[model samples]
Target: MGLRYSNKINKIRTFALSLVFIGILIMYIGIFFRQYPIIMVICMILGLLAVIGSTVVYFFIGMLSTKAIPVTCPSCEKPTKVLGRVDACMHCDQPLTMDRSLEGHDFDESYNSKKHSKTKA
Candidate 1:
């Protein structure tokens, strides 16, 4: 199979959305434990927490979007936000990098890590 790639911000947003669905599913499951009030309550609370956490994550991503670098994706010819040193274009999921030295190199997420950069230096 080919490598699956997507915009980092989009990926995080998708995760947050999935968390909301999972939280709702968990809460629904809790309804079956009507005889065990404690278990049901606990499950409901956990589910609520997950949903709330997802909201917080969504908000955080919004704040981060403002700070992300804006660039035109060569492959897509569309403007997109880059979250880190390396990121995919939001429009086309085209891999991109801000570092000229890494230009034309394979898309490696590790390039953003300090350990990997230090080793190269």
Candidate 2:
């Protein structure tokens, strides 16, 4: 775990984009198994399924976007949607918090957890 925490939306987007490439690669590999029609068909179906799964995931992200908190990133001076109690800026990766008590303090993702926050309280 490095100190480079990414924006939640950006992370999910990356995953979805990677999934598309993986699905394509899997489908391409199916061509190599042309001698076995059944196996090739199965591989093709699996690859298609992966692509469909990614579409569902992307849709889920869209649904979640409606629930995210919109705020201006102090560091970037641009509006971004924060997905959780703690999230990084979409533009600059600066840590943002919805908690007033934690403002202007060190950025700790733990503050978003109920157990950790309660223990600190």
Q: Which ten residues in a row have the lowest lDDT in candidate 1?
A: 1-10
Q: Estimated TM-score per prediction?
A: 0.91, 0.87
Q: Tens digit of lDDT per residue, candidate 1, span 1-121?
A: 5675788899889999999999998899899999999999998998999899899999999999999999999987989998878888898778888888888889999888998678765
Best of the candidates, lDDT: 1
- Clashing residue pairs in candidate 2 are none
What tens digits encode model 2's per-residue C-alpha lDDT throughout 1-121?
Answer: 5577788888888888888888888899999999999989988998898899899889989898889999999888999999877889998888888877777888777777788678655
Which ten residues in a row are the worst by lDDT in model 2? Answer: 112-121
